[model samples]
Target chain A: MLKYQQIASDIERYIEENALQQGDKLPVLEALMARFEVSKSTITKSLDLLEKKGVVYQVRGSGIFVRRHKRKGYISLLSNQGFKKDLEGFQITSKIIEFDVRKPTQEAADNLNISQEEDVYYVKRVRYINGQTLCLEESYYSKSIITFLNKEIVSESIFDYIREGLGLNVGFSDIYLQAGRLNEEEAGYLGLEKGFPKFYVETLFHLTNGQPFDFSKVTYNFEQSQFFIQANGPL
Target chain B: MLKYQQIASDIERYIEENALQQGDKLPVLEALMARFEVSKSTITKSLDLLEKKGVVYQVRGSGIFVRRHKRKGYISLLSNQGFKKDLEGFQITSKIIEFDVRKPTQEAADNLNISQEEDVYYVKRVRYINGQTLCLEESYYSKSIITFLNKEIVSESIFDYIREGLGLNVGFSDIYLQAGRLNEEEAGYLGLEKGFPKFYVETLFHLTNGQPFDFSKVTYNFEQSQFFIQANGPL
Candidate 1:
C-alpha cells in the first residue's frame, strides 16, 4: 500500500481502537506528520481519500474531524448481488441540493412505514461522477427517527446521520432493480433530453429483525451506464 | 389490464407453468390474437412490450421467437418506469465494440470465485442516449454458465436468456453504489472530457445457499441521468 494509504489505515485503526466517536477531532496535520514520520503531502492525500468516502472533514483552520456520517450505499446492495468496484474506474462527487422536512407521500409512507400524512425529512441531491451528471437521489426518512436533520447534515451523507447522530446500527437491506426512461423532471435535473433510457435501482433498508426504515431510488442513464453484480460459489 | 398486457401476462404464465425451456417458440401470433380476441395491433403491442423487456424477439418476416442461446442463470427484466419504452427514448444506439472470451482478471476471479485462469466471456458496448455519447459497459460472464453469446443478445436483455434458456431459478440480488470520475478507457468510449464524473454500481449475485455466482460493474454518465430504487418490506 502507498504511504498515504498506510496513514489512512492507521488513522482508521486509531479511531476504532480508541472508540473515538464521530465528530471527534484529530491531531493537527503538522503534528501527525511529525509523529508518523511522513510528509504533509502524504497525510493530505490520505485525508482526501477518507473524506471522499464520507469519513472525515476539515474545519478550515481548527483541524480535521471525523465526519459523523454514513457514506451512501450503492444500488448493487439492493439487488441479488454485491457491488463490483472496477466500473470505468469512475470517482463520484456529491452536491447537496436541498434538504427539508415534509409530509410523506403515499409511496414514501408505505415504504418507510410512516403514516401517510406524517412529516418526514427529505434529502435531495444531484451526484456527479468524473464531472458527468449521473443521478439525482432523493431520500425520505421519518422525522421521528431523524429529528435533528439540517442543511449541514444534508450536505454530508444521510447514512451518517442515521448511524452516528441517531446511534442506530446500520443493518442489512432489501433492494429492487428495474430499467426505465427519464421522466420530465429527472431529465431536466440530469440535463439530458427528455425520455432518455435509464436504469432504476430501488433500495429499502431495515433492521436484522425486519423493521422497514428507508427507501431510495437511483436512475442511471442506461445509454451511458451499465450494471454489475458479484456473486460467489454455485447455487 | 389492457388486452396487450393480458396477452403478455398469459404468455408469461404459459411459459412458466409448462416448463417451456429457454429459446422455445411460443404459439403463433395469429393463434394468440384469435384466442385472446384481440387485434393485430394489440398483439403486436404485447409482443413489443415483451421484446422491450428482452422476453421475446422477432426476426423480420420470419415471425417472432424467444431469443435463442442466451446467457443462463441471470434474468434481464425490464420496465418503462413510466417513461418511454425503449432505447429510442434516449435517441442513441449501441453497438458491440468488442466481444470475446478471456480469463477473468484477478479482481474478476475474486468476484466470481473461480480459478483466475478460468475463461469468462467479455462483451463491450458503447451506448448513445439521445445522440449524446453516454457510457461503455464491458461485461464478463463465466463461459461454462453462458454457453453462447452474440451481439444480438448484447443488444437485448441478458435476464431473458438466463431464465428462459438455461432454466435457472433467478431471484433477487444485492447491489453496491458509488460515485467516481471517468477514467481514460471510459472517456474514450463516452467521448467524454477527461476527468469527468460518473456514477458506478457494482453488484454480486448468489444462489439461495449464499453462494456467489456472477459479478458486474456498471458506470453511467452522471451529467445527463438519474436512477431510483423502490424497495419493499423484508420477506
Candidate 2:
C-alpha cells in the first residue's frame, strides 16, 4: 500500500477505536502529522482520501470531521482477501462437503491453463458465517501448484494454506459475478427455495508469476449476502 | 490511468482490433516501445500486467505469447462510469416510465443528504439493450444539484446530462449489490414472474465537492446481467 493509504487506514482505525460520531472533530493536522510521523502534505493526502471515501470531510478553517460514524461495508470488490480476512470481526467457518483429487474437467483445464492430463484437487465446501451457511463453493486446484492437501486443510482457508504452507504467492483473480438461481441441491444446502435468485461468483486465481492456480464457483445466500463497493474520482 | 496501464489498454485494444488468437506472438519489447513511444521498462510493466490478467505469457527466449485471446468482461465494479459508458459497444436505450418532481422520502433524503422539504426529480426507467428489456430503475436526484430534467433527458443517459448539460463534475458512488425478488408491480414492467429472483443495485452518488446528489435503485434480469471484477497484488 502507498504511504497515504496506510495513514488513511490508520486514521479509520483510530476513528473506530475511539467511537467517533458523525461531525466529531479529529485532532489538528499538526497533531496527526506528529502521530503518524508524516509530513503535512502526506497528512493532507490521507485526509483527502478519507474524504473521498465518505469516511471524513474537511471543513475549511476548521478541522477534519467524521462524515460517517462507522466504516460500513461487507466486501470490497477490489480486495483479494478471502471471506475469513475480508469480513473482519465475523466468525467464519467452513464444512468440506467433498474433497478429492481428480482429473481436471475441460472448463477447469482451460481456465487454469493446464492440460486435461493434469490432476486437480476437486473440493466442494460450504462456508458459514456465525454458523449459518452463506455460500457453497466448488473449486479445482492444480496439483502442480498446490502439491498436497488434506481434509483438514480443506476445512479452513485454502488460500492461507496455499500462501503459508506452500509458500506460493497468491496474486490476483479475475472474477465474474452473475445473477443466478438455486437448483435443488444448492437450495437444500443453502436452505433456500428452488429457483430463488442469488449471486454467483466465478473466480480464476493466479500466482504472482502469472500462472493460473485455481478456479472456483461460489453461490451466495440471497437474503444474508450483500456486496458493498465504492468508487471515486472525476467522471 | 497510469502510463503502463494506458499501454496495457492499448495493447488489449490492438489484440481485439487485430483478432489475435491464443498462442499468437505479440510484437517484441523494442517494437512495442517504439510503437507506443515509451521505454523498455514501461513495455515490460504493461506486458507483465497483461500476463497477470491471463492475456499473455512470456516465453523464455522467443517473445510474449498470448495466454488468452479475448478481453472478456462485462462490467468493472470499481468504475464510476454509468452503464452506457461502461458497455461501450452495446446499443442501450431507456424508456422513461414516470418522471416528476416530488418530496424526498426519508430513505431518499438520507441517501441523497437532502431534507424532506427538498424537491427531487423522481424518475422511473426501463432500460433495454439491443431492444431487449434488461433492468427497471427508480432514481431520486436532488433538484438543488440537478436544477432541471425532462422526459427526453430521462430517456437517454442522465449521467451524461448531469455532466455535460449541467456542467457538474460527478465524483463517485457507493454501491450496494444485493439479491432481490421482484414484486408484482416491478415484475409487471420487467416481464418476469412476480417472485422471480434477480439482482438489485442501490447507489448513492456524490459530487466532487463531497455533496450527495442522487440515490437510485436498479433491478436487473437474472439471466442477462453479469458483473466482472479483478483484484491483483499479493494475497
Candidate 3:
C-alpha cells in the first residue's frame, strides 16, 4: 500500500476503535501529524482522500468531523471482477450446494447463446464472510467453453479458474440489480426468515471475444451487504 | 435519435409488441433491412449495439435471438446526474409528502456538514413512473446554501431546481445501496405489503467546490425496478 493509504487505514482503524459517531470531531491536524509521525502535507493528502470518500468533512474553522453515513462492505459494480479482490481483512469461504453437468434450461441456453441440446455446468453455492452467510449464487456455464471445470474448481473462485487456469480473460459483464423476497430455499441457505428482503443480481459474463460464457443469479443478504458504483459525466 | 438508434428502437418495439421470448429468432438480416428501408451496414450496427446491451445474441449459423434477461430501468452508477435524463420515454412525477425546515438532526448535520444549531430543509416525496409508485425519497439540504427551495420545487425535480433555478451545478455524489424491508408507513405510500423487500440508497451530494450540501435516502420498490451499471476494464 502507498504511504497515504496506510495513513488513511490507520485513521480508519482509530475511528472504528473509538466508535466515532456522526459530527464527532477528530484530533487537530497538528496532533494527527505528530501521532502519525508525518509531515503536514502527507496528513493533508490523506485527509483529502478521506473527505472525498465521504468519511469526514472539514468545517473551515471548526476542524474535521466524521460523516453521518459510512459505507460497509462496498462491492464495486464497475469492475468486471469478483468481491474476493476488494474484500480485505475478511475470511471468505464458499459451500458448494450442488454442482453437476446437466442439460441447459431454455433460459440458460438463451443466455449463453447455446442450443438446448448442449449441456451446461450448473453450480449453486452460498458464500460466507467470517462464517456469516452473505450471498447465495446460482450459476450456469457453457460446458463447451468451460470444459475442464470440476467439483474442485467449483469449490473455489470460478473467475480465478477462468483467468488463471484456463488462460481466458474475463472482459465485461451485463448486470441487472433488483430487490426481492428470499424464497424458502434461499432463506434456509442464508439463515434468514422466509420472505426476508434481499438484493438480487443477474449477471452475464462475456469473454474477450464478446461471447458470453456464464450466467448467474446472486442474492445478497439485505442487512450485511452494500454495492458501490462510480460513474463519470459524459464527455 | 440517430439512424442506428432509431432502427434499434424500432426493433425493440417489435420485440415488445410481439412478446418475444428467449431463443426466439428475429427476422433475417435481409428482412430487417427491407422492413427498415436501410442498408445492411446500418442494420448491422444497430444489432451490434443491441447485442452489447444484452438485448439479443447471435449464433454463427442460425441468426439473432432474444436473450433471456432484459433490463427495464438502469441507474447509471458513474454519472453525477438524475434519472430524468436516462428515463426518456417514461412519464415521471413526484408527490411531496413532507417539506419543512427544522433543526438538523445529528445525522443530517453531519451528512450536510452543517452545525447542529443550523436549520436544514427536509423534503420527503414519492416518485411515480407511469402512475406506479417506484421510489420514496427523503432528503436534507443545507439551508445556508440551497436557500430558495419550496414545496412546489420539492414536488418536481430538485436537480432541475439546483441547476436551472439556483444556477449551481450539481456535482458528484457518494451513493450507498443496500436491501431492506419496507416499514408500514413506506409500504402504505408505495402500495406495497408491509415487510416487502426494497432497495435502499443513501446519497451525499457535493458541490463543484467539494462542499457537501445534500443528503438523501431513497427506497425503491423491488418488483418495479432494476438498476444497471456498465464498467470498463482497467487500462
TM-score of chain A of each: 0.60, 0.77, 0.69
Model 2 segments beyond 4 Å from truth? A1-9, A20-31, A39-73, A85-89, B1-12, B20-73, B85-89
Worst 10 residues of 2 chain B by lDDT: B66-75
Compose the digit string of candidate 2's lDDT tens values, residues B1-235.
6999999989988987998876678988889999999989999989977865656767667688664423343766655556765577887788888899999899999888778999999999898877777889999999999999998888877888998899987865677888878899888878888888888888888776657798999998776677776554441
Candidate 1 ranges with C-alpha deviation above 4 Å = A1-235, B1-92, B206-213
Considering the two chains of model 1, state its CAPRI-style docking category.
Answer: incorrect
The sequence of per-residue lDDT tens digits that candidate 1 reaches over residues B148-183 is 777677677665676567665443234555455678
Question: In DockQ terms, which candidate is top?
Answer: 2
Error of 3 at A171 (Å): 2.1
Give the Å error, residue B29, model 1: 32
Compared with the true structure, what per-residue lDDT tens digits does model 3 show for residues B1-235?
6899889978988987999975688999999999999999999999976764556776656688875445555765445556775576888888888899988889889778779999889998999888999899989999898987888788777777887899885655677788988899989989998888889888888765546789888999887777875433321
List each candidate's DockQ score: 0.04, 0.48, 0.27
lDDT of 1 at A92: 68
Q: Which ten residues in a row have the lowest lDDT in candidate 3 chain B?
A: B226-235
lDDT tens readout by residue for model 2, A84-173 = 555788888888898999998898998888999999999998888888888999999999989999998888777778888998877656
